[model samples]
Target: MSPACFYGDSSALDSILGISRKKTEGALGQHPPSVSYVKAEQDDLLGLQPDEPANPKVLRVAIIGAPNAGKSTLSNTLLGRKVFPVSSKVHTTRCKAYGVITEDDTQLIILDTPGLTSPTKAKRHNLDRSLIQDPWDSMKHADLVLVLVDVSERWAHTCLSSQVLQCLSRFPQIPSILVMNKVDLLKKKALLLDLVTELTEGVVNGKKLHVKSLSRTHLDPARNNPLPSIPACTPENAPKDGGCLQEGSEVQRGPGSDTSCDAKASDSGHVLGGTEKAQTATPQVSRDGKIKKGWPHFREIFMLAALNGEAVETLKRYLLMQAKPGRWEYHSKVLTSQSPQEICENIIRGKLLEYLPQEVPYMVLQETELWEEGPSGELTILQNLLVPKETHVKMLIGVGGQLVSRVAREAGEELMNVFLCDIHLKLCVKLKK
Candidate 1:
């Protein structure tokens, strides 16, 4: 099938590409589908059953942000365990959902997605960049969107990227919360006020966010504000129509939102913006089809650090309180939708991203070659780290394979903790021809 037809329709694409599936599968060394295409097929291929209508409420939350914004770390913190891998590198998470928190009355299925990036920057290499859009795609499947912003960095213009704005604009009615992550890293506490103002107004560098769609020549940051400044709406003045302001009452920031002195803080896939949900008017787009300037109005603001377990409980409580009359989508016991092999692959990849330098991490891929279950509930796993060049392989192996061994040791410890059993992890670095 032509590249244009690949994303047209799953069934049509599948039918047209029938002959190529075998060859594609073989080239990855009997590997599972590439990261870009796995989400499309994971559920259909696994045949995992949905929840049995036991719980009265279910909250499908989508955690979205730019690469290295710590979405995975937040997910792990929320679940009270590490089901997803946290990495400093970009695009650590492809498309994966973890049915993280389970309450007696509510089940929160967290959809962890790839970080959002500009399509042009993502597709520059022509490598499989499909996962770049996964965050936006996951937004359609979400009942609530937790927009994670890195507040540690100063805001020159807007807090969010254009990609995030475009996705939120597409679903104007879906209430979202602006979560200011890594606030602990903020050296100046007073800057928080400025950060909040910039995010609400969607202005950056004292100018409205620049988008390719609007007439760029007409917009002068000093002369005209292309995007209207959104009126600051506090919780007391929120709209009553269950629209823009409804999401604010759900979270209370700082020590006042039922928490003291610390701050912090979707579903395993059914596409966002399904027909079952109510639809609102689509936001205006520029003539060139580029996203017009408009900052998103968060339902509420949550400031928390996911790494230090700061205010994570407060965020969890807010989610539980969102429970309404609905059936749970995932089984009560399941923590994530990912298979064992996929989890192992993510774990190993996280280590490489942490330890490897330069372009080596991005050019390499890891796959679980074997997963043997022992009688005592232990797991023996073997994974291969595939590199494109011989030099890359040597970098991965280090001198006398010391680097690989270090990666293996750290990966094994985490695996043991997550799986709750003994793990013997073996890493093999191979140069891909």
Candidate 2:
């Protein structure tokens, strides 16, 4: 199908392209099909992806970002869950983070990795601590990669710049999209636009390199927006014979609605202004030669915006456009790459704990020694918080043990919350040196 420009209610655009319509009817009222050909050419990367014969293939995407760059937010939004740790503090992530997207027999596995740069060298030069290159090691093998930048932070500092260049260098071949994270902090879009231009001109081996930006936002303003409203009434008429609108299949607008709005021919594969749940609208020609809204898949559009950005109609069209139909596809399904045990081990390795400074100014390290499982699947664990220097320990203990009481109470509460059982957590600070 040729690219078609869709016009209608301003609110309707939300569902017309990326979103579905039944999801937006309450806001824009039902309508007859308004069809027009999309006459513009632009970036449609979704159209240029790996697919199967008549099936939508999952797109494996990796997101690489600086410490505390809202990588977790993007991951959480994509997964529609809170599996990874998120914090205002830097280095909340140490190992690679994973999220999966599965819809309409297709699954997309997403990988989020630790920000990589040179830390040892950065500290010596009084520069920003760099992203550890360890994560980039994985980028060596990715179908697609997304490099994220904190739009909230000004484009200064050599460490991040170095890491950004390093990223482009590593994934010179794979398509990469630069996502300007935390966009809520910046009002001047020029800053982000300018940053996009500069990043497209990154470097390799300290030499100038160029690339393209996929899709981005300082932050997705609509990340948690309300779900699109559904209609209270279905079309007074329905489609006929599992085919185009028969004799009386007239999908009409809601009460007090006008047909003056531009008829949209959406690539989402839905006829303009049709409900998403029940039927797919095909712009049926009227006796007057003007097309009325025939396709309605609005619910599917909202679903895509809420989860990963793939509507059901788009999925079908994507499958059909590839011209390859398939009963099965490998890439579209979410495959568990790492097991629970493996994830736990990765965390315990202290590899992902880079968020903890080398010299934690006011904190210390503690490790549990044993775990005793109890009835109802509860657990009792014993641990000791270790500290150095007698003075520090005494200071923590406080005169009359007041300090110890507060500290012990806080620790016990955390333990109980984490294990959800009786925590016989003991506290003792030994002075070393």
Q: Which candidate wins on lDDT?
A: 1
Which tens-of-lDDT digit does each residue in 357-389 have in candidate 2?
A: 344412444554554555764444444445675
- How far does residue 132 in candidate 2 sit from its true spot (Å)? 2.7
| C-alpha lDDT values of all predictions | 0.59, 0.39
TM-score of each: 0.68, 0.46
Query: What is the TM-score of candidate 2?
Result: 0.46
- Model 2 residue 59 distance off true place after TM-score fit, in angstroms: 3.2
Put down candidate 1 lDDT per residue, 117-236, tens digits, no spaces.
776876774435656767767778888888888777554224577787888887877777777778677764334444655675532112222112223443446854223211222212
RMSD of each: 16.6, 18.2
In model 1, which range of ten residues has the least summed lDDT? 265-274
Q: Once all C-alphas are superposed, what RMSD does model 2 give against the true structure?
A: 18.2
